[model samples]
Target: MTDKVLALVTGASRGIGRAVAERLARTGHKVIGTATSESGAAAIREALQAIDPANDGIVLNIADAAQTAEALKAFLDQHGTPEVVVNNAGITRDNLFLRMSDEEWEAVINTNLSGVFRVCKAMVKPMLKQKSGAIVNVSSIIGTTGNAGQANYAAAKAGLEGFTRSLAQEVASRNITVNCVAPGFIKTDMTDVLPEAQKEAILATVPCKRLGQAEEIAAAVAFLASSDAKYITGQTIHVNGGMNMG
Candidate 1:
């Protein structure tokens, strides 16, 4: 790899995305993180500047096709193609299958699944031209285990995993790898709001007896996006603290 390879991470305003962006920047990547709003983008830029002055962030709503295209075009024009892409922008609208509204399902699917498709589509062509790139998608344990009130979230994540495997096969010969990091019960803004009793009940199911940290997931993402993982592709690395082991 070059001394300063270009890397893109979506939803980098906070949580695991921020951690991944920081880790990549520390490892010498010129990171370009993304968020949906100006404030979020500013946060990403500020966080990344602590590591490298050249690293910055952009505004991108991956679920919006036109917005995604415009953002990617501007970014590509300014920074060339990213050597590593992390699809971490996602949303969840948790509701039981019986009560899940069309809007809820579409929101989750469009953002989590289709948004990833759009981001990968924007990056893969450039990656194919470069003939060397790595794409790490952020997935969820609920995708495999199936949560009761997260039908929409689970479906989108499961779809993402399938998409990753298929795209990995398509690009492996081009020297690009596609993989996923599925995290379970990670400590984040979402989990922080859970009631203490609920949190304790959740921890009881995990052999580790604790929640995973954002940095922990970031470590897995870093590994998958590095040259050290060159031999790995079309795989999902679970970072759930033994909550759902194979």
Candidate 2:
């Protein structure tokens, strides 16, 4: 196993997660990315192998606590404790709060908000012992600015930011920094698959004409993961192109 710092990207099968995994591998980090399924794992392996065959990949459903614990243990048993952890796994169930089913809210909260709690809890001991670590959560613009039909997703993400702040303080003395990155509309398979008219409507709300590239977010992750960002913690770096800046 490469001794360079290991970075884990959850939901790394595609989109921002995939891009971050590949970029980290290229930057010489031992990238161990997670997929929710076998096919997704294979895609991650192929993508990483193309960059560096030594790269690592695994399948994980963060919402499953037992599986999550086992996967993290196996990942470390093979690669090692992560020096950088990106909580990028997420899902969206858009509906008016009044109409949103309990399952929808529970699923989103469990995976996006509660899921991070699970994964981070598992990593805390390892990171604390290491005396250093970095966490970057993938939040959403809707988290800060409530959306019409994404109450569940927005609540989960907003909670994630608060979680980041609380966790950052808890680990600050250990030399670990925790932060979040809220991406605006990013062009990816996830977004590309959206209806064209829907895409146009989103663009109208964004001040910039173009959507963000996955690389842009990856770059932000890389920066925060590096020593250069040692002074920055408990902060949310929004990559939205002038959309809802606070």
Candidate 3:
């Protein structure tokens, strides 16, 4: 792949997305990392620049369909369609299924599941014409194991896997592979906010004896998005450090 090939990483302001953008940039791809706020966009830009001093950053809210389309179209118009797209923009509206509000459920689905669809739909045209591309959706261990308070999040992530598998088959002939990475207990901003006791309890279950880093998850995404994984598609690679073996 050329160093100029553009890669778009959603939720790139921090955590796993930021690490993934840095990794891809280090590999020579001109990465575009998206954030939701002005501060977030600034942060992403600064973070990416810290890695390569020339990578791009933009603001995007995946849950908003119109903005998602417009932002992607703008990016493609200015830089070119990203050959690699990472669907890492996700949110959690954690609550028991019984008490979860409809809005909470909708917001989670819109951002995590439908957001991936919106992005894939916008980018597939150029990828199909080019006849080469890769998409890696970020899933979660909760999606597979069903965490009690993360009904909305788990459902959305689980749906992303189904979408990846089906879309992989649809686009494989075009040389565009779709896959997913299910990360567990990553020490991200989200998990950092977890209660100390909860964090400790969760850490005990991880055989690695510690939480995985965002960089660890980024490594998996980089490998899967590279030509090294050309023959791999429609697969979900777990990066939970032996938390849930499948």
Candidate 4:
């Protein structure tokens, strides 16, 4: 077996996912980043060129069970199971609970919650066989704070945390750890689209008086996947710039 650790990061076209993929690669892993579209996958591949020429991206819409299975199987057949897997692919459909359409709720839940389910299901067997792996899921503060106009997102993220805990218990005996990283407001394309006034209002609420960086979140994920975190699982590390603290 190759001594080089391998990591797979979903939704790596941009934002926090991209940062995680690059960070893992820089930390000595051969990273395979996924994007929903061919163009996005290409962009990921190009972005990682500076770190490792062998680093590449794949087109994977985690919402599609067949595609997720096929892609994962092909990777396993070729490169074996990754030592680290980050479930970072998620979407948000904002609307009041009263006005939330069935399509909107389903879309967010299916992609954010069920997609991770599919990925985990596919990875579990290999991880069990390998007897060592880390699965770090990206959750959100909205799940805990309960943001308005984001019922679907909150529900999905909360469900993800629950899922993380249960899976951690089931696989801990095999030395596989499952954990979550819940980020507060981060400056991604999703947050960048907010109006200036709205952005300022949010910053005002954060004790740090600024939005979190993608790299900061990536750092949290890297730690959780490292040996330092081998004894820690079934928990969440909130990286929200003191937006919401215990």
Top lDDT model: 1
Candidate 1: tens digits of C-alpha lDDT, residues 1-246: 246989999999999999999999998799999999999999999999988899999999998999999999899999998899999999988788999899999999999999999998888998999999999999999999999999999999999999999999999999999999999999998899999999999999999999999999999999999999999999999999898888
Which residue segments of model 2 deviate by more than 4 Å? none
lDDT for residue 34 in candidate 4, whole number 0-100: 94
lDDT of 4: 0.94
Steric clashes per prediction: 0, 0, 0, 0
By lDDT, the better pick of 2 and 3 is: 3
lDDT of 4 at 150: 97
Give a tens-digit lDDT track for model 2, residues 2-117. 66778989999888998888888888688888888989898898889888778767899998989999988888777767899999998888889899999999999999999999
TM-score of every candidate: 0.98, 0.97, 0.96, 0.98
- TM-score of candidate 3 against the unseen true structure: 0.96
137-202 per-residue lDDT for model 4 (tens digits): 999998889999999999999999999999999999999999999999999988889999999999
Clashes of 2: 0
How much lDDT does each candidate structure score?
A: 0.94, 0.89, 0.91, 0.94
Q: Write the per-residue lDDT of candidate 3 for residues 1-246, one digit (tens) a residue.
A: 345768999999899999999899888688989998889988889878877766878999989999999998998898777789998988888889899999999999999999999999999999999899999999999889988989899899889999999999999999999999999988877787999999999989999999999999999999989999999999999999999997
Which regions of candidate 4 deviate over 4 angstroms?
Answer: none
Q: Candidate 2: global Cα-lDDT? A: 0.89
Model 2 TM-score is 0.97
